[model samples]
Target: MTRIDSLRAGDPPRIGGYELAGRIGEGGQGSVFLATAPSGDQVAIKLLGSALTGGDDDPGPGFARESEILRRVAPFCTAQVIESGLLEDRPYIVSEYIDGPTLQQVVEGEGPLEGARLRRLAVGTLTALTAIHRAGVVHRDFKPSNVLLGRDGPRVIDFGIARALDAVATGSGVVGTPPYMAPEQLEGAQVEPPADLFAWGSTMVFAATGRPPFGMDSLPAIVNRILHRDPDLGLLRGDLRDLVAECLSKDAARRPTAGEALMRLLGARDRPVGFLLSAGSAAASGSPAPPHIPDSGDAPALSPGASRPPPGAGARSRARRRAAILGAGVTVALASGALVHALTRDGAPARPEATGPARPLPEVTSVPPPATTELRLPGLGTTLHENPGDTARMVSFMYDSKGGSNHYARVRGTNRFEAVAPWQEPLPSPDGTWLALLPWLKESTPQPYDFVRLVHVPSGREYIVRLTDKPLQNFNPAWSPDGTRLLLTTFDLSSGSRTPVGFAIVDAAAAKATLVRADTSGAPAAAPFAWSPGEPAVALPFGAGPRAGLRFFDLNGRTLRTADGVGEAAASESPFAPAGKRFATGCPGAFASVCVWDTATGRALARFRVPAQSAFIGWYNDAHVLLTDKSADPHKVVVMDMKGEVLRVLAEIPREEPGENRGTFLFHYMRWS
Candidate 1:
């Protein structure tokens, strides 16, 4: 259930009333020993390691002061202290050993908690703070790593005794993790409950987004941001968003009291979980529940060859003592380039250019697939019948006037479609072997917390690839010709404006991704781009920003070519022709006009005018182009030939009510079977 470390040589077998078993946890200040109490119950005894003992065999005045206060804290959503004593002038405190992972472990591995789990995490920790403050004890170092996600609820650890470390906050010495420290604490001023509340808000941000609200940085830089900058909490919403921002107020006196913050959370607990939640309520029961109860902490550390500690392992000081803490639990198998070419079009496809070096990106890995009974995904909206013999598949968040939205899947056929799982923005691979689910599909956290979830079609296995760590948004994911890589464009936020920056190429199996044609020196280019399917080049739009359209970039961040006279290619449209030689996109103005470009010559070949208020989807074939009209009763797909002739129309996808904002939501991104 949690990552446990084994005993090592030179470890003392016994300390007073406890028999030391193994090393369970190691922090900057002390080593937690998993030991047996006098009555045989398991307990964690934290003894000051040699680093803090100072080779004098005695912990100074700090230890005695810590021991006196810890004894007063009773058990109530916190680890209950059993006893504290000195052995050979060395100090140790024994408490009930909680068997769960740290809050950091849960968010880092799971990627920003949601649903009842996130609620339980919030309410439980606040309850702990209420109880701790009620007892007149302040947990100065409240952070993600210090909160243990127990099975029953969240338990705040490292509460009363952390003061023994006596680490300062001003100048060079930081008493706690800088990102979680309040402005007053960072200023080395006298701190109280408000300081801890400030840390609580920062912890909530990390629990909700897998990163600190202020972003990671050096100690000096973090202190500067803490004083001048507000947290980048664009991913959070509703009550949690407002509360976190309030607690993080730069003015110490402006921060809410712990009890006041608790009442605010309890108020939110009484209402609907808001638009950010998966459903109107958190769990199926629909009754208000404790917010932090569902945060289940999994195993600890990395298996082998992990060059770095996972998530919250880095707390307090910059230096960490590395040991064999993380054991093997789950692993991802790399199976790249096993895809069979699915479809081929007859055309004079241009020769793809020789690629340069590749950027080393982190690989996406799979977890053990969740086991469940056969799922029935019903009501997948209007199905478009494809070639009877074709095997291509499509996935959508089925929206019915009566039923609302549900995850549904169907191949391009009249065959009965079924629901596989509840996920959003599903894009099947060109080969139909895998389905890529966008992270923002089911959850409501902003783009920064989004992930690219890939599911195996046959086994229903799912893997996640974190697209970007920065507070950014992305859309329009297109699979490569081989189905091994995925292309998506990144958007940056500056002064409250979100603009497209550059296109990212993701290796699904490897879980690594890199951006192309992005401005490395200045702000990233804010424009959409589409891959040429089989080639190394991509077609991007031209806009008021750098790296805008009429430009082609290779897989590696290099600009290949640029064309003229093509309208600003929107991210919603791809330019590559079915044969992969020409580019097509909607015009820049209010009129519905389609512009096609020759990829080889960077020249406009033809321009066709269509009915107003229509979008250019893509080319069905070399001669036939596909378009969609929103004004129709049912959304109609219009097919036009290269000669500007109206060829035919396909089925319409029912439109939702006007004014409903589905961020970057489109009809579908269909890949060949």
Candidate 2:
């Protein structure tokens, strides 16, 4: 049954002296009722379904197994199992009621969490997993629905299907949801803790993308995909990709243990080392701030009057403080001296000298440019403007079609044509190193599009990256700044309607693809619009309505700032200048204007208009701008200097008859070399 179908409503009157107030949830094995005890505290009473408890034809021990596992693990993780007894000829177990919605509900309603919230969720979930694993139990069903975001943190629930590590006969009849189940589970192999790791990977995917990795409609198909298919990890950010990759490794031994996973979730590799070094420095400097050694128990309290010392005390007081600090420093040094002495020990670099009084953060202002220019492309029947700082040597390829065939041709010296290829759909890499081609009949019977070939410009070597068996129609293949990843938006026609499902990021080096997010109505996914130069975060464009704009997000899907509407309002490739201080965008149509926007604030700084309609914009050096305009007879190429003054008329092509317009003139796709 589907998840929604399993849920039961209404109260069951009474069960084992507890009054059932309402029905909370249900699953294939049992039904959970919201009930109250004599003390008025709430509890969830799970009653085994008739199918599992045993029908008239047979008697089974499903409830017995659940009770045993719950009793064993109650002390370590999950709600306290208050009692278990027979009610209405069926065994039921009551657990402490947890007040919160499931992780699945949260993601479905609010998309994904970011920044501190995402980290905290990961830590809490891993901690729960660690507790369960230490109790010698494996929670076979660990989907998002089973994880509740409690008032304090996340609490892992639904251990009803949990099994002992050594148990041989647990009556495994394909337990757990197929999308979240591990490959081994699909193979009906003996389950282990690694299975939970696989589940955690799926859970994390759901948390990040608001959906499972595999997009299957049926249970059987999902099961098949999980057994043989590799999960798409394109959308995951930062260290999450590597961590999730390790957790979902095919081999159980390769998967990290629950404890190791927890440490990774807590960023132990970065945190513990930094904490130790800072604590050491504080003690050596004679600071009263005690070393913070994080433990698995309650935090230690500071003694009364043990407040922080003033920043600049007198020399005599400083000497006394240093003596006290030296004593405390020696104590810590002796205790940790035997520990692994690594780079952070005596070899640590000395802190740099502080500069003159600290300066305030710079304010970002969106300054409009002084002027704008319009460009025209006669061959491609389009007009665009050149962005600032672009060199005149760069070229742009525009889509051109004639005689029922699609091709891309660059505008050469003046109004000349230089044919690159015979593909109608073309997506160029940011650095112009590679080109992604899509060849499909615009109007034809629907078919699955399977492969994307990436061709290196210089060597002409092609690599086919296959995403799925279904026919694929996609556009906008943008390369990440490093050129290691390619992001493409896909359109799936299998559902009869055009569903702009989502985008996938393909690791160019590995030739593997992973789905990042799904958009039902063809809206753009929250993919990074612009990658930070030599940094991990990308300027992501998102939000709804007029408030929708751009913000910076780190690789781990963490929002660095909600600086929406912070740049020129234009669509597609907002190529930043060399200094990254400015960017340019094209405004289409008759009064085609190119506007330069200041990156700091969302303001139109400058605007320059051309004689014809404009389509694309590119910068040529710091002074001249190349524009494609379609208004002048014999469409013209207009060149403008940085101050918006007309520098030169690069070229002009005579207009051709409607039918002959295909071959008379060619437009160059402009790019900076």
Model 1 spans with C-alpha error above 4 angstroms:
1-405, 411-414, 420-423, 441-450, 515-517, 520-526, 544-549, 570-573, 587-590, 643-646, 656-665, 669-673
Give all TM-scores, in the order shown: 0.45, 0.40
- In model 2, where do residues sit more than 4 Å from their true spots? 1-11, 56-66, 74-77, 160-172, 270-673
Q: What tens digits encode model 2's per-residue C-alpha lDDT throughout 148-226?
A: 7765456687664434211223243777888888889888888788999988988888787777876548987787667
Q: Give the TM-score of candidate 1.
A: 0.45
**Per-residue lDDT of 565 in model 1:** 48
Clashes of 2: 45
Residue range 231-305, candidate 1, lDDT tens digits: 878577766788889999998789888766764554312222121112221211222212121111222112133
TM-score of 2: 0.40
